[model samples]
Target: MALLDKLTSGSSTPPDTSGMSKQAKLVCELVADFNSNNLLTQIRNNNRSKSDIDKTYKYPDHFTSELIETKNFKMELLKWKNSHNPYVVLQFHGGGYVGAFKTQYRMFAGLYSELGKGASVLSIDYRVAPENPYPAALNDALYAYDWLLNHGYSENHIILAGDSAGGGLAMALCHYLTDRDRILPAGIVAMSPWTDLTASGSSYTENFEIDPLFGNTNESLIYNSVYPGNHDLTDPYISPLFGDFTGFPPMLIQVGSNEMLLSDSILVAEKAKSQGVKVRLSIYENMFHVFQMGMTLMPESKKAWVEVSKFLEQMMVL
Candidate 1:
């Protein structure tokens, strides 16, 4: 198949990338080659252990790293200089509810600190599935939030962000908060979030053969692991694409035009808008899932983080 035909196939409209950065396109090709081993699937089927997913990036030495112990888990806190009302971004790492703590997450914490004005960052090493299932991670996230409040950080100081499964978790945390009539956070940032575990989105199949990490395979390796002894797939706390956004905070959602979860971000953006929530949605041309992780390596990724900065500034001002 010609390159143009491959570009136009099953992606969102226009599919035009004649003007796209050469580096962005290069990363796409590199990603395809890198994922040829099906690393994610190997982890899902227990062919690989969770320890294999704990890759870390070499981040700045200025930020302090601490393990905040809770009765159930240890939360990682990455912070620049500490001060009263210091900007805080509570993050969750994505691994399809299985993968955790990747190189990109550390990069994001550093980026958030620089962009968010010396922001303090926190990430929960939430429990994963085939071991600890539904409500476990969600419960851990709730504990993290309450832990912040009890320690004197206002809800206004926090902006939740995540990528892929972690992105869905960020939104689901808000759904959990709103339902309980708790104070909501400052905002949310999601990158190629997997909002529907059922793989109900048209893009799930439309982009199947093209999605570098998740194309044309048994999706059972996904939600089946996170929600094995399950409730309904559409349950707001699990899928979050079916979640409530009324009274939710401002949001920034970014997705790749080429990812299978493209529809996940689009659907949630529309839902949040309908419910009168503030929303900013951007779809990058000819990219892959969680491509923002490559911000250190690609212009498109850097561009997406710039959008995140603008949104964070706007949220802080409001």
Candidate 2:
């Protein structure tokens, strides 16, 4: 059955992990009660610097990630031999604008590369906030896109993608490039994008109790301080949901049903569709944030990736 159908099936199960794989249920149970306040505190104090990107991240054994350095940050470019147009996914890693999980992003890039049937993946280490603050990440994203363009990758052959804050950055990058008349990517793929920094979405209150992450907690508020670094929560770049998507590229957004950020993804899809952008959204039933990152045994994760593969194929054809 289609993922969207799972949501619309109207089943009235009361369990939070309904429709989740047993493995996904376990994963959700682990984090549903957890909060990242301590972790954020450590990062804020610089006790947990993103040094893990170099020493801690393990690349998938299937491919080698080429390290490319810009003036300010390093990027991992995982190239695959495409069977069709030479395509690339310029990706961003999510850590709520403060955390850096290069290894996780590398693994995600591996999926994009494989699912894309040889499309290359270029994942960047954009500067995060509290240490780097707003606009820093966006600036680096722009540079990464430009690097691809300069290296012979056409805008239409490139896609912007990321999860969590990185996902929001992907959308915001389109806004920046679009406003400046820079070339936009062929499409966008966001997994539980935090597009609304304002935290104003109704989901914040609706899913507050059930969300496995950031549920009924102040963890997101900490990010507000360390990331946005200002009171301008509604800024289009800060919160891309407020940005115009009149001419943006096709977008594929996948979000878990129980995520507090569910509204973030849904609102963006509605806006994009209203503006005539082709959008495909899959709200996995009772799943949590970025459930695609869960263990491989999870059926939802695999299906979500299959959806990604399908989207990439369609983009190439277009």
Point out where model 1 deviates above 4 Å.
Answer: 1-20, 38-59, 82-85, 219-224
Worst 10 residues of 1 by lDDT: 1-10
lDDT of 2: 0.78
Candidate 2 residue-wise lDDT, 1-318, digit = tens:
132233223543322334667888888887753444566544554633364456545544545667877898888888753335488998888778877655656668877877676788898888876678887888998899989999989999999888988889999999998899987899999999999877788888899889867776665542345677764888888899999999999999999989889999999999999999999988889888888786244667766776787788888853
Number of clashes recorded per candidate: 1, 1
Per-residue lDDT over 1-318 for candidate 1, one digit per residue giving the tens place of the 0 to 100 score: 121122223533432333457777777677667666567545445632243224444456657777666786667787775533366889888877765455456667777766776678887777776577778778888889888888777898889988888899999999999998989998999989879887788888799888776666664345355543557888889889898799998889999888888999999999999999999889987778888777645657766766787787787743
Clashing pairs in 2: 129-133
Give the RMSD in angstroms, all C-alphas superposed, for model 2: 5.4
Q: What TM-score would every model get versus the actual structure?
A: 0.86, 0.87
Q: In lDDT terms, which candidate is top?
A: 2
229: Cα error in model 1, Å: 2.7
